[model samples]
Target: MTTPFVHPYLPNSAPEVRAEMLAAVGAESVEEFYADIPAALRLTGDLDLPEPLVAEADLSRHVRGILGKNRTRLSFLGAGTYHHHVPAVVDEVIGRSEFLTAYAGEPYEDHGRFQALFEYASLLAELLEVEVVNVPTYDSLQATATALSMAVRATGRTRILVASDVRADVLSKVEDFIRPYASLEHVPTVDGIADVAAVTALLGDDVAAVWVSTPSATGAVETAMTQLAEATHAVGGLLVAQTDPIGLGVLTPPAAQGADITCGDIQSLGIHAWFGGGHAGFVGVADDPRLVMEMPHRLFGLASTSVEGEYGFGDVAWDRTAFAHREEGKEWVGTAAALWGIAAGVYLALMGPQGMVELGETLLARTAYARKVLTALPGVSEADGAVHLREFVLHLPRPAAEVVEELRAKEIEAGVVLGEHELLVCVTEMTTQADIDLLARELGAVLGTATDATTHTPVLEEVAR
Candidate 1:
């Protein structure tokens, strides 16, 4: 006599509808659908789930309450992900209805979207000093993976030499993606940057590319790029350089530094670090047909329209993409981070050349000051002698992880822990001088306490002995 329960949110949950659907599918009951699943593997009894908040208002309140518990803390943690200032204009532009709501619309339907992405590619190409740039990949990691794959295809070689100092996450991604088609070798480093002599030694006929990161994971600027490129080319291999687009304002472009292919993430360009959600990858190559034909992602180009003096934007090499050939394509291309590409385009339009240079200068000045202050503290020292820009390594007396935990308790997020005593710290334009001073003071106090504890603990141990 009990009324049958029906889910308020799920459509066709009513008893009559369920019976009708089951009858239409020639199944007497829902259990019949799971007949293929073995009894041992099948779940039994009621699922351990909270009572459903059926009402929209109740669900909103529940989600808000859970989110309220998160405390906002000042963070300096940047390994691959960074915390940079996103301009208000960038957000306003991306939030528009046409850009935000549109899916993968065609060129005829989404002309504005196509033009916007083309502008983004053009602006990025200008910055990187490359001739051709793709729309974007999933992120910089994917861009790098694809770039290496392109190198393999172009050189007809299976071996890739990657710098040992690349960020761990990026290196992992490249390893996973390239394992099926190519073999990866790590080039050793000297003083935090790639050792050109070692890289030269690793190069051979089997090598397809030599991949290096400028302003590497340890924040050391790679000065031997031209040498590395020459060495790679000497063995008939390509040079792929991974760099941060934000740093190109001051640092030399990878393509200009003898890179055959350049790739990097645009997250630092007017994109908010929403728990690492905001990232889009860019890959650039020279005008050489060999390199351009190997690109898997869409490339936008401008052409003259039927109307005189009017131009139209559309995909350049549409026939080469996975969208056209499916299984036969060089690589699988899925839905891109097109929204983030648009956001980065807006940011570049706003910043222009001078603004970008000023921003780079600001970061340089702030980072130098931070290093000077923190290195002056007792029991704290620089991990490497190389010159750094936005990020650097700090050797601490205490465990870096323990220091990070203590700082978190005080509502401050210290940098990423590299090891027991090594911490990788990042400073961007968002970080102010006062913030740097505060971190230095807190770090000094923590190290002072740790040093005293170590000084006493050893004494007690010696007395016991």
Candidate 2:
């Protein structure tokens, strides 16, 4: 019997099939179709592509086998994403068809989703100590860009001053989004925090907003936030703070610290680190009607039902969303991460105010202990030279990537590589004293000096009590 007309993996790509397609398109060759293009632009070689899988494949099992090859190393690596523990309940709720099915912002279709997102926003408002909170804007990084856009639009200015210490990738994304609409200037940092003196000097009338971060990229809590807010206010610029909602438990919420606007990721609450996604972004402001109207996403508010006492949720100021007015809407993220927003609401509802506070404290104590254990190695210096929280930057003598590679050999994913000698390390509730010790011991071995067992402090015992 003749072999079926097929490519190894793409079954429809046999030579005979290609010929028929070419004939239908009135072309002798694939190259002949684009023959009008200049010779210099045309490729001179076959495309370098991966070899297709064998046709005799149990596709699902094969895919799983390939996926299973991925090593589940003990991780200390949180630069762009985190490794917070997700309660089984979060997934149990998010996985249900109702929450997962409602991506469109259709209040009529799924009233429960709207109410859940409303609860999420309300919870965020309470946590940040701000009056307004948006559901989600793509992700935390894009939410930051959206927040800055709001500041620039609100002030009617054409320039933005972003802190140099904001995550490099987030900064780049914000710069890309805002370049056509406004000019960007970066304020330098010293010791992993925004330099207050430098920030104050750069504020001017043309500046729309000054963007700063708390527990900044290096994991050091930004101490100059209040002063920066004041300086920005003095020059008629709003202070936009990018923060982690989890950090607000042990640290001051941005609103309380004089920020005019606050934006951040709420992944640490109960969202799993499914790589760079499944986390929601939030934009918040004080109780200002003008600011409320400027928010780019949907807003849900509670109202009294027909009974006059019972409450029901409904759209608050939704004319601002793209759905209400497509051509002249705030921004179109109507279908993006809407489910994650609902999931976040479930997380907040499950955790409650006291749970959030306790989680924050646990992270603080645990991270502090981890830092003490890791930084004890000779020649290791902390890059973030302030009150580091949750995450920290360590400067080692050897290249970070190389050290991390050596650690990975022992099934330990040490941290993120920031530079040749810099590693960005993160510690969360999931990170234990034994985990910290393993990282230190392996890191020390990689650095050419094994840690002395007797001298190594008992981090778990010391912190647990």
Candidate 3:
């Protein structure tokens, strides 16, 4: 006498519809579909799930309420992914139906998509000062892995010397990805920057590449690029540099500094930090055929079509990609973050060379001001003497994780915790002078250095203004 159950969201969950599907699949009941699964491993009872909300309004409200508990106040957390202001135009361009829905396709069928990616590559190459750039990979970690793999194949060597200060997560990813093909040796650093003498000592005939990062994991700029490049080249090894594309406006491009290959993320380029969803990797190299041929991802190029005054964009060196040779390819290639490439292209177009320079100047000023203000606190000091652009490290008297937890209760995301005493702080154009002052004041209060009166005035005045 009881009516059969039917899921409001899943029409196929209706008993009659499920019966029909089971019949079509030559199965008597849903249990028959799990016949291949081992009896011991098979789940015997329904999963412990909450009752489904059948009403659309109820589902929406539930999701919103859960998300509402997350802190939405001032934040300064930037290790790899950053919080930059994404322009409305960039969103509008990428949100178009064709771009939002389309994946990889033929140039003849998806000419607009091909052209957009070609433009993205061209723009990124200019920023990196390299002759060629591939379509974006999954994220910067993948790009770094692929770059190191290329270095190993190019020099026929098995050892890679990585700077000791590289981000822990990024280092782990590279180590795991290159474990089968090569080995990694950590090079020491002084004052948070790579030590030229240390790198020189590590270089040898067996070294395939020297991996370094500008504004390294601790946010220290590597000032010894020229010396490092000479030392690496002396051993016939390549210099592979991972850099932030946003900082290239002011910092010297890796290619100009003698890096054989360059790779990094494009998350700062008009991409929203949707809780770590907005990362895409880029790899660049000079026009050398040997280096270019080793790239595993798709490369889009511009060509003149048969029609006069017409240009077409299509894949360059198609044979080198896994798409053409499958398992025989140099590395396995799969779906790329092509949409983010398009988004980045839109960002670059909006912020021409001048806009980029202005942005870089703003970051430099903000970062220096923040360091000066925060270091004035009682138990806080600069982690090192190295100059930084947008990110810097601070030494806290207390454990960094404990301090971060306390700040979170006040609805302020302090920064990324590096260790017990080290906290890596990042500043972007989006972080206002008032926000910086607020952070400094709260931090001083937390450290028992700031009085109630001093911490309250500047913030009030700035907010009132």
The lDDT leader among the candidates is 3
In candidate 3, position 129 carries an lDDT of 96
Best by TM-score: 3
lDDT of 2: 0.80
Clashes of each: 0, 0, 0
For candidate 3, lDDT tens digit of each residue in 1-465?
A: 024666566677777787788779888876776779999997777679998787889999999999998755688889998989899999999999999998867899999999999999999888999989999998888889999999999999999998648888788899999999899998778898888888898789999999998878877778888888889999999999988889788888878989899998999998998898889999999999999999998899999999998989888999998879988898977887899999999999999999898898899899999999999888899988888978899999988998888877777789999888989998899888888888888887777774453436433233444
Query: Better model by lDDT, 2 or 3?
Result: 3
How big is the positional error of residue 345 in model 3, measured in Å on the Cα after superposition?
1.0
- By summed lDDT, the worst window of 10 consecutive residues in model 3 runs over 453-462
lDDT of 2 by residue, 122-179 (tens): 8888889998887777777888999999998889998888774788878888889988
Q: List runs of model 3 lying over 4 Å from the truth.
A: 1-56, 452-465
CA lDDT of every candidate: 0.86, 0.80, 0.88
Alpha-carbon shift of residue 403 in model 2 (angstroms): 0.6
| TM-score ranking, best first | 3, 1, 2
What TM-score, computed on C-alpha atoms, does each candidate reach? 0.86, 0.83, 0.88
By lDDT, is 1 or 3 better? 3
